[model samples]
Target: MSDSEPRMIEILRILSAHDKPIGSKLIAVELREKGFNLGERAVRYHMQVLDEKGYTERKGYSGRVITELGRDKLEKGLVYDQVDFVYSKFEEMIYLTDFNYMTQKGNVVVNTSTIYDESSINILKKIIESGLSVSPYINLNEDKSEGKIEVTTLCGTTIDGILLNEGISSQPQYGGLLKIEDYKPIRFEELISYKKTSLTPLDAFSSPNRTSVLDVIETGDGIIPANFRLIPGVGRKRTLDIINKLDHIGIGGVIGISDEGRDILGIPVPEGMVGIAIVGGITPFRAVQENGEDIDIKIAEEIRNFNTLSPITTKITYHLKPVEHDIQPKISFLLSKSWNLIQQVNFDIEKRKGDIVANVSYLKRDDLDETLNIMESLYNDNPKYINPYYKVLDHPSDDDKVGIATICSLSIDGILINNGVICNPKYGGLLELTEPPLFIELISYNGSTVDPHKIFIAKDMTRITREAGSKKILASFKEIPYISRDYAVDLLDTLDKIGLSIYKISKPRELTYNAKADNYNFGIVAGSGLNSIAAVREKGIDIHVKAIEKLMPFEKMDRL
Candidate 1:
């Protein structure tokens, strides 16, 4: 074929491979990889020739892409012979696997007119996925040697292979190439405000806003290295004083505002309004009152009369409005459609703190009661919320403290009780029974007989045998099956010999006292197998529970 004809074929191959417009720099790299060694001027000349031949079209300034005719030629294998010629020339030098070399040098160029082999197409897919520019080079041969694939860019930078695997297609422009005339500045006067009028039904008795505040307060109790601020106004001071009084009356400690509060709340306070901010945990909430002047005076009086301690107080000088535009007024169908398209642009942006929520699980009724009791006891003993409740979780940790109750099942090998007693004793001797008749059984394959009569005077045994020498154990106990104190002591001793551990006996009184709302049943349930409970509480709220139980005594269910 003639020189012009081959060049035209190469141009078609380039265009067909890339979905985006190609520049001279990129085109030259492709020609170089094809062993053409063409300069920018020569590539430009070839492109002009292709444009004249209706193989490709010029877009914007200095941008050229393949025409439909050029793509057709590639898809039909019309440019195969030309590609073969180019490949034959560069077979020894081109590295198919080393895509970085092409991307860095910007030598990986596309001529909207050339056809590409499947392997070349795969390489191009990788290059695009990496969000990196490919060098303008064409290689038709594949490299079999692993190290031969040195994926370096023209800038001499090595690229991670993972970058290439995540390639995505650039969003296509609409209306036959975007132009300045296609976009117009939005007219403020003509723009109609679209309001988000939808309202979620709020519970009458429980204020959603107040509940959110309480949640924030609970989260702030943890050892977070941040300051919390109270909003300006009389009600805030009064609320705080009440809380302080509650602390005096055996409630938890209150979080105080930090220096960061000024930074968060230094916005414009509306006429006859004051802003209060609390920033201990994650995000800050703003509270505004209709009468700031009057509220401030009332708060000062409350602080002086009620709270004799270092009352939480902070002074605010400047106030500002939230930086985020209230999008509720602009959320029209048209804007939503535009937003949907805008999101497709895939622009990188930062997210705000308010955009995220803490992944904390709500406390179960029984768990909540236990927590409250712990909190109340701490407050009563100290008259201050001094002892930060170290929440106990099911997982064992050295950092966990005693009485820091977690909503976890009593392991067959019971948790250590407050009285220094390992409730679920893996091995022990006779001792004073602190609570009551302890439940014991062999849930795993193990040996070491226990004399039930010696352990307890009135023994109600639930025994199962597993494979001898197995490590699993299952046992449970309730307070109802009362036994003599001496018998309990003997039982403990026998349990120590049998290699059985103790599981805590949950009391019913613990559950009933901590009911937050009326009609909620609070109790502990433990068993010896996979246990699941998903039931609705009295207030139409759902609770999910899961526990694992095991059978003891290796020989119980042998065959079947």
Candidate 2:
């Protein structure tokens, strides 16, 4: 109805006729050929206008596509004035031999790219559907050795040209006739060679069904008519089985199919056939050895042997240390004497492969009598020592009360207080010792004991000095001495000043009691008057069940 309406309709028609979205440049070319004056910019503007009105939509930056509204309008029919103008323009370009001819069918100008033939039109439609834009004519000039046929698209851009030939051996030259942009060139000689080796299929078959046939073609190695037989009733199951077997044998592909012996099975034309294909070449399997040499046979044999044997379950060994010190002198002595004592006490301990020897020595002197006599007197006279040492040792001390001094030693299983008094009242009295002592005993478990001869002693005087602060008499000798009362007193003084509490003492009776007991599980028996001298003697040490009752109140007496 408006002056621009007819032009807009014409633009819509051009776009609707294209198989793909048409670019503004192509639309401009179409308009130019129709004798209409329009530039690329003007065409682009009209396209945008159409798009805004919902008649067209932008496909990309360079192109536009017809929308549903444009299709509906085309079906309804064009106005008379627009139709006449389109037809007059089409008439100027129409040719008799050209397939794309313009004709008037009522008020519509019917311009078709196909000749007025059903087969030709159908072929054209198929080509378009296949995503190809074909030219209006085909050049068939046999005289021109390298005939040139140029084709321009509606967008005025030349895509690509093809070279036509009669036979497979023909070499394509520049610009013959066909326009094939997607296909790659293949020589007739190659195809013939493939055919000779049964590589090429005689007829096209679906990829899935033609697997065996294709395989035969590949492995034939340029040889022709290879022979092979397929088993009968070879449906999917048999086919798959055969394929797997063939693969294992280094054979591949299906060259030919036949039913040479299916009659014996009473079946006609077996479900699948045995076929002749080529045997594929194989590379021998190999492994690199530690010496970097390729080992094929050895590796294969090893793999075969490994596969034959049952898989072994790997096992790992773990050693758990004693969680709590039982305080039995023999067990504690063994454990403290050597680090390996804990390992030896395990019931499940394995015999070690090598010999384990322990070296031990004792530093003794008569001058230590003074320090030892004082410690012995404290144990005998102190009321705390009247009962048992452990009871006095286990009791808590007053906040401001500094504990007594003592001579102590490291046993295999635990610490040993030689001459000391329990000072903490809760355990009866805290222990005081003149110096750490040296003792020998076999490592033991709940009842079993090891050899005492295997015991080792290593004195850590620095650790003792650090533990016993500078308050006691022995703290003056910070460095350890191999002899004399100065060393003994210094060690005790260092221990007392360092705030180290007395843990346990060395008593031969504790070891003897554990050795004689049916079950070596003995609890500590100590009282407030904890005398270390009496505690060490076999008969003097009394079993104070009351201390056990007091220390382990929660523990069931029967359980103990």
lDDT of 2 at 241: 48
Per-candidate local distance difference test:
0.27, 0.26
Off by over 4 Å in 2: 82-93, 96-560
Instruction: Candidate 1: list runs displaced more than 4 Å.
Output: 76-94, 98-560
TM-score of each: 0.18, 0.19
Q: Clash totals for all models, in order?
A: 71, 64
Once model 1 is optimally superposed onto the true structure by TM-score, how far is the C-alpha of residue 531 displaced, in angstroms? 74
* Residue 294, model 2, lDDT: 25
Model 2, position 78, has a per-residue lDDT of 33
Tens digits of lDDT, candidate 2, 146-172: 332111111000000000011111111
The residue-level lDDT of candidate 2 at 232 comes to 34
